[model samples]
Target: MGKIPKNRDEALWTLAEWNLSKPEWQHFYSPQLKSDMMIRIAKEWKLDGVMLHYNRGCEGLSLGIAENRLAIAKAGIPVMTFEGNMGDEREFDEARTMDRIDAFMETMGLKRELLHA
Candidate 1:
């Protein structure tokens, strides 16, 4: 505050003062913030499904990923959570990832239409 408020009712705050007026500085801390943002983005862009990534090494980000996936799926769209590590080659498995992706697509009513003879 520029100065102490003269009275309890004199408090005034602006988004700029809270450092939330900038795109990079703004974030929603609400319980459903992440889920809401994802749903909104998908709806706004007319997305069919959501593929969420889960990095094994990042505990903080990986935490509650299952809950997040459930919330996203509750938005009436298919959601997929793929497990992998950013820089760990051992965690990267093409066959498993592709299989999961294929299964997710099938659950979303999508089929692999291309066939090689």
Candidate 2:
């Protein structure tokens, strides 16, 4: 109780670090960390591209996705995003998603080869 913020800014900053509740702080923290993580994972895996799903159903997880995509692309990683809903099929467009995925692959100079399992 004694370890409390003196004012609103301090309080919100603390909360932002903990839960990312403040919008402005979120803008700063989310993009940087998310981008760094994506970049790290891409490097570690020697990935050719990254795919991001903008889930319309979960606003919190979707936050700063556009910024993340931009950052990942800036780091010389091919990145693409498709908007969809995890819990609701109505918000998902399968054809569009597939087309976008194909485009992404094309941009990476990849050609699909069908394999028989």
Candidate 3:
């Protein structure tokens, strides 16, 4: 869901069909396609890092996330993953997610800052 299409073909398929490689991941998002897209976008935008939300009920989408994180880290930016479920409030863990987020920010040398001073 985070990757930006690199070309017209990708844009069309990614947006319209989700371009996912297999059927295990979510019905909408393609884990394989998204992994590739994220790697590219992180490089293109010079991003500081990436975050992966592995839904508890969506094993299909979360299956290859570890590999995705590895490939993304190869680009020299940190990648963080946390647990949660889509549309299921009971599966969400606020404290754990927050901890991972904090760790990611610390790894990236980021700190809370005022948007407008």
lDDT of 1: 0.69
Write candidate 2's Cα lDDT for 86-113 as tens digits: 8898999999998898888877777655
Angstrom error of the Cα, residue 41, model 1: value is 0.5
lDDT of model 3, residue 85: 88
Model 3 clash pairs are 24-60, 25-60, 25-61
Give residue 1's error in model 2 in angstroms.
30
| lDDT scores in order | 0.69, 0.81, 0.72
The list of candidate 2 runs beyond 4 A from truth reads: 1-29, 113-117
Q: Name the regions of candidate 1 deviating beyond 4 angstroms.
A: 1-31, 115-117
Off by over 4 Å in 3: 1-33, 112-117
Pairs that collide, model 2: none
The candidate with the higher TM-score, 1 or 2, is: 2
- The sequence of per-residue lDDT tens digits that candidate 3 reaches over residues 1-117 is 588899999888886665344444432464556567778778898887888887778776677777778777786778888888886989998988887787778776665352112
How many backbone clashes does every candidate have? Answer: 0, 0, 3
Task: Flag the better candidate by TM-score, 1 or 3.
Answer: 1
- Candidate 1 on 1-117: residue-level lDDT in tens? 357667645544542344543323323333255666677788999998999888887665655566668878888978888889876869978899888888877777777563111
Sorted by lDDT (best first), the order is 2, 3, 1
